[model samples]
Target: MDTPKIELTKDGSNTLVHPKYNAHYHSTAGAIIESDFVYIKSGLDFFIESTQTNSVSVLEIGFGSGLNAINTYRYAMEHEVFVEYIGVEKYPISLEVVQQLNFLNFFSIEDKEKVFIEMHQSIENKNLNFSEFFNFKKSFQDFSTINSLNQYDVIYFDAFAPNDQPELWTENLFSKMYASLKPNGVLVTYCAQGHARRAMQAAGFSVKRIPGPPSKRHITRAVKI
Candidate 1:
């Protein structure tokens, strides 16, 4: 895979631009804001409130820039919630490129910066406990092949847009995601396309369209009921 070019989002956070796919790792409007809204606020926060659980297990479909992971880590620490985060990335960016990203600048805390660096440095498929509240792991494999069953409370479906990665938004792939989640597990994505929602519905999810981040009209939240 070619090295992704580091670009700054509007809010001064970094996002990667894929050379081959011609897509961005995150929204250009604001990387951190988009991740916070779609994954952290809509997915993890909603799951926590709905389940009232002290611990959360999250499965992220695309762990491109590590923005969502870092944000989730901060949320867990701030709220004293235990989180087991499993992120899947088929092609991880180089550490040098990851270092070029301006994501850590958003945090003034030394420990949070260290934790963010540790998250990128950790080996794939190896669980690294950043703290008592946060357990982090990465998988350098395709999300479609992940077969874990009934293990996650939330799914961050942060793949590229459906037009860019149509196969990932298919019913077959969502069926796998549905099977990976526990009962009533929620899957949130930045996309609110009709076909995508219908595909989730086809895979036994109760889909809902919700407000999206800046520049985006709506996002999708699907639950396995």
Candidate 2:
């Protein structure tokens, strides 16, 4: 993939549109505008908020530009909750490009820059524990072929849209994810394609259709029942 074109939005948010991925951060209209839409509105908030467990483990299919991770970190901080955020991404972005994404300003204190750098650099495929509020493992591989089961409390299935990558949305892939989640764990996505919903159902997820943000009409959330 080509280097993404880095640009700033009117709200001073960063956006990177590469030939393969158009990732946007910190804007109201971009790809990753709000956690409410990308995570919360998709019912991730409900799972995270309602869980009584001391430590919550999340498995993200595509870490992408780290927008979901960043937002989840902020949420954990605000709620004083413990989280273990694991993600898988086949094509990891360069460290420099990751730095250019500017996640520090999302927090209130200027010292957040140090924490941001630490968190971003700590992501590795091997298991790593970072403090009480955060920990992550980056599986530098495809999600469909992942072989773990009954590990995660929440799964953020935020792959590129089915139109962009159909292979990631198939029934077989959802079946893999279905086995990956702990019983009653939730999986959320911004996609609501009919086939995708059917695939989730076929994989044994109790799916729900929810309202989406802006241009999108619907999003999907599934519980491993």
* Candidate 2 Cα misplacement greater than 4 A, ranges: 7-12, 21-28, 109-111
All candidates: TM-score: 0.97, 0.86
User: What residue pairs are clashing in model 1?
Assistant: none
Worst 10 residues of 2 by lDDT: 23-32
- The list of candidate 1 runs beyond 4 A from truth reads none
Cα misplacement distance, residue 77 of candidate 2 (Å): 1.6
Error of 2 at 6 (Å): 2.8
Clashing pairs in model 2? 36-41
The Cα error of candidate 2 at residue 119, in Å, is 4.0
Quantify all predictions' global Cα lDDT against the true fold: 0.90, 0.73
Candidate 1: tens digits of C-alpha lDDT, residues 84-203: 999898888778887788877775544876787777877878889888899999998887898889999999999999999999999999999999999989999999999999999999
Candidate 2 per-residue lDDT, tens place, 43-146, comes to: 55677566666567888887767777767777677676788888787776677887887545655633355655555565466655555676666677777678
